[model samples]
Target chain A: MTLSEKNLKNEIYDFKKFYHLIKAFTISTNISCKAFNLNGEKIASFKGPESDTSFCKLIQKLNQEKNYCMQSYIYGGQQSEKLGEAYIYFCPYGLVNWTVPVIKENKVRCFLTAGPVLMHEVDNLLVENAVKMCPMLDKRRKEIKSKLSKIIVVDTIRVKYLADLLLKLAKIIMAEDAVDLNNKHELNIFNAHLVENINEIKRTYTLQGKNNKISNFQEKEANLITKVTSGDKEGAKKSLNQFLGYIFFYNADNIEIIKCKVIELMIRLLQVVTEVGVDYNVVSGIKYKYLKNLINAGDFNEISKNILEVLDYLIDCLTPLINVKNRNTILIAINYIRNNYHKDINLEEVAAQVGLHPVNLSKMFKKETGKKYTDYLNEVRIEASKNLLLRDDLPLVQVAFSVGFNDQSYFSKIFKKIEGVSPNKWRVLQKEQKNFN
Target chain B: MDREILNELTVALQKGDAIKTQKFVKIALKKGYEPEQILTEGLVSSMNTIAEKFKKKQIFVPDLLLATRAMNAGIFILKPKLKKQLFSPIGKVLIGTIEGDLHDIGKNLVKVFLERAGFEVIDLGNDVPVNYFIEAIKKFKPQILGLSASLTTTMYGMRDVIKALEKEGLRENLLIVVGGVPITESFATGIGADIYDMDGTKVADKAKEKLKCSNF
Candidate 1:
C-alpha cells in the first residue's frame, strides 16, 4: 500500500514520541525488553541488567528464524496457551521473558519480548508471600522477587513502546517509499543546484589564477590593496592610519599589482558579504572605502556599482558551492552505485555523470566516504553474495554470477579478501551456527 | 639571428606556438648567443608572460598548457647547451597526488609554479601510496613535502603518510604542505598540517610563506 507524505510524517512524529516514552520507562522501572525479528535479529532493545554483545547477537539470530513457536512452563494449574505466534512468558515474581510477534500484512516482521524485571517497593507482605510460594526462590527470594518485578515492569513498558514505534516506523517507511521519493523533483533540483555551483567555482579557478596585480595605486593604496586583497580588513585599517608612509612609497606603475589585487579582494569580499546574509550596513563600511577610492580616482559611480553588482553575483554563486552537503552527494552516489553495480563503471564516467572532474570526484568520494569506488562496489557485491550464500538452493557459481561477478573464482578471491573466508566456507559457518542455535 | 628573432621567439612562446618557438630557438642559437642567457632571458620570460596572463585570467589552462608546451620546445633546443651549467637547485620538494586520488592537474600546476618560482620540485605522479611518500621523503630528504589529495577518502592517506614519516622521524625535519578541493583551513588545522591552500596558485604562495618561516 502506498503511503502519502502526510501519513508518513504523522507516523514519524508518533514514533518519535513513542521512543521518548520507552526511554522514560526504561529509566524509571529498570525493566528491559527488546523487539526482534523471527530469525532473532534484535531490532531494538532496552538496556539489560548486564550488557552482553553475545546476547545481542543471539537475539538477532533468533529474530532471523522464520518459524514462530511458543512454549511456556510453570504457574502450576493456571496454565496459559499462547495467544499469538509468539507469547509473553511472564513469571509470577515479575521477571518476564518470551518473544511476542509484531505482525504486518500477515507476516511476523518484528517480535516484542520483555524480561528481567526489577520491582522497587517496600518488601513486607509481597516478599513474605513470594518466600512461601515457589520454593526454588526460598533462598534470597525477596531479593530475586524485588529485582525481577522491577525488571519486568520497566522492560515491559519499554518493549511495548518499542513495538508501537516499530509499527509506526514500518507504516512511515511503507508510506514514504524512500526509493521513489528520493528520485523525485525537489531532490534533483537541489543536486543540480549543488553541481552547478561546484562547477562554476572550478571553472572560475581554472580560468582565473587566484592572483592578479593591481597596477595603479600609490604605496598607501598599495598596502591597503594588499591587506584587503588578503582578506584582512583590520590590518588594512591599522596600516591606513599612517598616510605619509603610503605617499612616500607611491609609485603609480609599481602599484599595478596592488590594483589588480584589490579588485580580486573586492570580489572575495562581496562573496563573504552575501553569505553573511546581514543588512547592507555590515558591508557598508567596506563599500564606502571602495567608493571613496573610486571617487578619488574620478571613476564614475555607475561603473563602481556595476562592478560591485557582478562581484555580488559571483559571491552569491559560491555559497551553494561551499555549503554543498557531502552526505547528500554520497547518499545519491550510493543509491546510483547500488542500482548500477552490475554495469562496468569507472571514476571518470561516474564523475562526469555527477558533474565533477574524474580526479576531484575520486578525491571527494573517498574523502566523504571511507572507501574507494572499487572497494565500495566490492562491498555491495560481497553483501549480495552473503545473502545468496545463505540459501542452499542457489549454486555457488550461479550465486556469484547473479550478484554481478563474471567469474566464480574471481568472486571467491574478492569475497575471501573482504570476508576473510571462501564463500563456501562462509555458507557452511552460517549453516552450522543456524543448526547449533 | 637578429634581435627581432628574439622578440619573435618571445611572442611565439607567449602564444604557445611550439613550432615557431623551436625555429626561433634554433635561429638564436645559430646567432651564437649563450643558450643559458637565451633560456633565462627568452624562454623563461616568454613563459612568464603566459603565466602572468594565466594569473590575470586573460588565459586559461589549455592556453597555459600550450604555452608550457612551447616553453618546453625552447628548452629542448637549449637543454644540451645548458647541460654543463646545471640550473642550481633552489630547494628540493617532494610533490604528489595522495593515495586513492588520481587528480594530477592541481599537482602539475603546483609543480610548474614551483619550478617558475625557482624551487626544484620532484613530481611523484598520482595515486601515490603512503610507503612511497615515506620512501621519497627518506631518499630525497626534501625540505618540503607537498601532499595533494583531491578526494576526502584519499586525504586520510595523508595522515597515514605523515604518521609513517613521523615513525621514521622525518616529519620533525620536513615541512608539510597540503592542497586540494576538499581540503579546508579548518581541516588543515585538524590534521596538524603546516600549510593548507585551497587552490594550486595559493599553494605556491603558501609554500613560499612556509619556506620563509620554516617554523617547523
Candidate 2:
C-alpha cells in the first residue's frame, strides 16, 4: 500500500478540518485553489465566487487537452516536493501557477495548487500569444481576453506570500500526523534562516562520514538497557535522547536506515524490561501500541518522543507491578534493591522493607525475575558503575566503592564476569573507536 | 592542483551549500590557486555530477538549482580574478524563461554554467516577453539566444520569440537555443531554433562550436 494508505487513517489524519481551512484560504485570498492527496487525486478545491468565470476554467473547457490542467498542477506539486519549497511555474495556458507541498514528517501529505491566473494585463500581445496557444482560442480571442481581464491580477510578491500562507495551512492540516496531536502545532517551516539549514547539512555531512564508523555506541546501549531494567526511568530517558541524537546525526538524510535502527533499539529496550514476570498479555499490548507508534513516526525527534513515551508508561507500569492487582512481593523487593544497590544493603534489609521474610523475598525474586537477589543487586551496581566508569576522572577504586563494592578487585571481578572484559578494556574499546573522519 | 580543496568544494556544491562554496572559493584564492582551476575543477565538475544525477532522478530540479546557485557564488568570487586569463569570456549569450513563463530555475542553471564556460550570459529572468528578447539581442548582440519554458502551454512561446527575431532580421548570425521540458529535437526544429538541448547545460559548448565554425 501507499504511504498515505498506511498512515492517513481517518482517526489519525483529519481531512474535514483540512477542507475547511483550504476553503477559507481560497475565499480569503480570492484565488482559486485545489488540493491533491499524496496519490495526486483531487481531494478538495475552492473556486471563489468572483472566480467563477476564471480564465483557467474557460481555457480548460475550450481546449481539447482535457487532462492538461491537472497534469500541470501535478507537475507543479511534484516540483515543489522535490524543491522542498513553493514551486512557482507557469500553467499550460501561460498563466501564473504555483504549488506548495504540505509535508508531514518530511513526507508530502497533500499539495496546495494556487493558480492559473493572469499575472499581467490582457494586452494585445498576450492575446496574440493565447490565440496561438490553442486552435479553439482562434474564434474565441475576444471572449478569452475579456474573461482574463475580469479576473483579479495578484501581485507577484503577494502570490508568493499566498503560497507561503498555503504552506503554513498545509502544516496545520498535517498537525494530526503526530501520534500525540493535541499540542503538535509547533511544526517546522523554512521560515527560519538558511544558515541553520546549511549548518545542519554540514554537521550531517561530517557525521554521515563515509560509513558512520566515527564511534561505536555499544557501551551506551549497554548503559541504556541497564537503566531500563533497573527501573531508572529518568536516566533511561537521558540515555535514550543522547542515543537517538547520535544515530540521527550518524544517519542523516537516510531516515529509513534510522527508522530501522530505532525499531531494533526499541524492541531491545522493551525486551529488557518486559522479561520480568509481568503478565504476557499486558506486555504484548503495550509493545504493539508503541511499536506501531514508532513505525508511524514522522521525524527523528518524533521517533525519540514516541519511544520515551513508551518508556515512561512501561516504567510507570513497573512501579505498580507490586500493587493490589498481583500483590507481587518480588517487584517490591526488586524496587528496594534498586534504591539501595549503590550502598552496602543486603536481601534481609530489602525483605524487611517489603514486609517479607528474607528467605521468601529471595525465593520470589528468583522465581519472578529469574535472577538471584544477590545477582540482581550486583547487576544493578555493575550497570551504575559502568556509567561512572565512562568518565576518566573517576578512578577504578573509587568507581568500585561508589557503586557499593567493598573492594576494587571484586568490582573488576564482577564486571569481567558480566561483560567478558575488564572495565579498562571496555573503555579502551570505546575510546579507540572515535573515527572523526 | 590542491585537489583536496577542489574535492571538498565539489562535495559542498553537490550538497547545495552556498556559504561553504563561497568559503572554499575564498580559501583557494587566498592560497594562490588559479580561478580557472577552481571554476573548472570545483564548480563546473560538481554541476556536471548534479546534471547527471538529475537525469537519473537521484536528485531533483531544486537540487540542480541550488548547486547552480552555489556555483554562481563561487563565480561571483572568481569573475574578477578570471579576467587575467585568456578564457575569461569567449562569447556573449542572451537567455531567459521566455514570454509568460515563470519557471526560472532551469534558466538560472543554464546561465551560470554558460558563464563558467567562458561565455558572458545576460539573463532576462522569468516571464520575459518577445520584444524584450528582441531588444536584448539588439543591445547585447549576443551570439546565441537561449529560450527556456518549463510548461507545455508556454514552451511554444519559443516559436513566437524566434519568429520575432527572424522578423527583425536578427536570426542570420544569432544561434537560437531552445530548451526546457517538452522541447524535443523535433520541436526545436519546428520552432526554428538552431539548437534543441533538453537542458541548456551544453548550450555554451554548442555556441562556441558554432561560433568557431561560422567565424561569427
Per TM-score, the best of the predicted structures is 2
lDDT (Cα, tens digit) per residue for candidate 1, span B78-152: 755653332786577899988757556567666766665667788898878888888888888898898887543
Least accurate 10 contiguous residues by lDDT in model 1 chain A: A75-84
What TM-score quantifies how close candidate 1 is to the native fold?
Answer: 0.27
Per-residue alpha-carbon lDDT of candidate 2 for residues B1-216, written as tens digits (9 for 90 to 100): 557888888998888676788889999888888776787778877876886676566764345545665676678778777643445578888889976566675677577667766787888888788899888899999888888976434655787888888889998988888776544554567557887654356766776787788767
Candidate 2 lDDT for residue A53: 48
* Local accuracy by lDDT, each model: 0.56, 0.69
Query: Would you give me the overall lDDT of model 1?
Result: 0.56
The number of the candidate with the highest DockQ is: 2
Docking class of 2: incorrect
Q: Can you tell me which runs of candidate 2 are displaced by over 4 Å?
A: A1-437, B29-37, B44-68, B83-92, B100-120, B138-143, B149-154, B179-187, B195-202, B205-209, B212-216
Off by over 4 Å in 1: A1-437, B1-90, B100-102, B150-156, B198-202
